[model samples]
Target: MSCSCSSSTNTQNELHASIMQKINNHPCYSQDAHQHYARIHVAVAPACNIQCNYCNRKYDCSNESRPGVTSYKLSPEEAVKKVLHVGGLIQQLSVVGIAGPGDGLANPKQTFETFSLLKKYAPDIKLCLSTNGLMIHKHIDEIAKYNIEHVTVTLNSVDETGEIGSKIYPWVFYEHKKHRGVEGAKLLLEKQLLGIQMLVERGILVKVNSVLIPGVNDEHLPFVARKVKELGVFIQNVMPIISKPEYGTKFGLDGVPSATHKQLMKAQEACDVNVKLMRHCRQCRADAVGLLGEDRSDEFFKESFADKSFEELAHHYDLNQRMKTHENIETWRRALRAANGKINQEEATNKDELSSNGNTMLVAVTTRGNGLINDHFGSAKEFLIYEAGDKAIKFIMHRKVENSYCMGKENCNGTYPIEEIKNALSDCHLLLTQKIGDCPQKELESIHLTCDESFADEPIEISVLKGVRKHFFTAS
Candidate 1:
């Protein structure tokens, strides 16, 4: 069923109450609350079902301050811990979100588990989920059941582009199989729009995040805005495309430059005619912490790990060493917490320099959550892209390769084409992974891609900042 909004019988106060009750404190949905309140995203959903050419989910989503990155992924229990811990520290933290290092609904078990736990621990905090909207139809009932106040669904294109109207997404996994090209894009768009319609019918606030890929979807977004508005989306967030050659997205590799601020504003202005435009978005990460105006994810990570080294905590979450996907890390965490209390007590005396600014270099990190550089280069299915400037580093996108060479049983007989690797990461200046073989390493180097194995034990922000300074700035 499509959204059927009515206003004839509704009073102005009734309308205001409905809107405020849902978005009064949601920073992303409400512009007024952005400065006054804080929101934290727990990266509990590490799996994704769709593949966007523009994303490499290997780095924290705080890229140069854009969103779609997280320092690490967490189990639902750990997510609850981080929320409670950060909530105690940041009094203004009014919202807890599961936004993905991947699609939130794609990992419903993890997303709902985290949400259920939050109800028990931090009931007052608003619950939010950000999904690609492929699985939204299947999960809409659960979303309403859980009282998820806000949902952000990314709608890249609605006007059909022949085979695949939306060049933004390449494939989607639905009904347990993969659908590619136009069919996949069509299926995704159908579900996304239908899901938004369902949410609106449920009286849930919906925000549409349309990535303005100029020359690709820029001309197509106004159509999207009108369609989504008809479906009852409360606001439309027209975000700029951060495409760069070094980041290696299909669009980036094809030499698609990021949309300028002027172009972005223009797109928002055009879309605003149909829907309420969200101009105050920061594009926060899936595991973002702190207020909407100020991100404290790095600071929170440092404080959380003050007692234990990243390497020590890595043992619990290393996908290579673990038998169960979500093995109980509580015992391991308890031991670490005992050790950290004393260490953090001493370290708390000195201020941590977890600033976000640094030289603006796009760096990709290989990780399997747990907030550490743990994934090997060849086996990595996702690469989290970040933009690191002198003062701060923020996550931007997640690049999902169809298949990693090392994931198959084949040896390095050049099975992974050098061109494919080059195309995937032509825009990135640095690649951070726990390990890389000589062949892939050399192939990447041939394309002017620098590799860093030294960041294996560091937090994402620290590693990227240090690497950017040492690798790019020191030479300058």
Candidate 2:
């Protein structure tokens, strides 16, 4: 349950140093940034034996997908091609994570094949994988063989009977039998701890992601943290439980999310360890592609996979295209955007409907970033808004250029006036812009609009309409 770190002039040392430097210096990991969008996750696993109440295999952590949402399932070879295609387009391929709508280990054949192919084709790519840790103990050798540097296991509680704990995973097929309740929890925990010990012993970094649920495991997180740190885990990411009320879980009832930043911070302070908090972590989609804070759904569609039809890709991956919901469209959009690809507006209709009718959509778009779209938008001097029924309106008054800002000259194509932009959105049912902070709240409320903060451009969405709310804002 302990690990030793010694500095040496070995290749591993150099590699670790390089990776660490990249993480620390990268814009995606910057402390001041409100969102981090550097990593990409691919859900190659389609089935899981164990389940947690807080998790719905139907959807991803970001709530971008529901269980059985996608119709695409690529073979490892196809996945590798897709990674290469995406990596080539994205600047910092910081981490390639294999998380799941199901357990990664449960799909060992696909998981390992994907990892092996990534190593073969994108060796320099930093590797990451998330699991429930039920089958991690069995895959330590394979994980190490691929030189995986980071691994995350979702551990909500230690003791099965403790507060903040639930026997959510009723049963798991272990040796082909249903192991339920405490037995399943114990089995999962045992494998988790063993996996942590093995990874640390082998010099691989470990991170434990605990979803803090109030009255459930909120009180028990300190125990989880202390235990993980003792096992030489480097970071403890205490994530808030994302509850979906429509999914019929006790957790998401009352429309309130579990825990708060303040509560999680308090727990971290109490844990009293060298564990670092992953504040910018985005519980991304299984097939998410983007930098740390930005979403590139549009880019992914336009660029990386533009040649591949959505239906064809879905069928190839064995995704259920027929039952594919609005969630699937968003997931596709997000993936495309991450890859700097362009999404055909005409084809995005079905996906657009997945969004709520009254939902306000804000797109913090700029052409100035150090990416491919620099030429698409002429200058970074003006911001533009494309409403559903109106022509693209330009905000000339808000023009100002800044340096090193993700939405600025080096990072974005340009800037634009805020007031002028708002005026243009006045007639639209919803306003989608690079940001809305500069816009007057009275203007947004006047339009009966709500906002989607996940547009990757705007950092905040304050509704002027009393009681109306905005959800999922990702600050750049």
The best candidate by TM-score is 1
Q: Estimate each model's TM-score.
A: 0.62, 0.59
Q: Report the Cα lDDT for candidate 1.
A: 0.71
| Model 1 Cα lDDT, one tens digit per residue, 323-398 | 2211233344344335323221111111132233323667888875434677888787667766665444655445
For candidate 2, the TM-score is 0.59
Candidate 1 residue runs with Cα over 4 Å from true position: 1-12, 60-64, 161-166, 302-476
Candidate 2 ranges beyond 4 A from true positions? 1-37, 59-71, 160-165, 248-250, 253-257, 272-274, 298-476
Q: Output the worst ten-in-a-row residue range by lDDT, candidate 2.
A: 389-398
lDDT of 2 at 276: 52
Tens-place lDDT per residue, model 2, 254-308, is 5546555446546655553445555445555566667543445334432445466
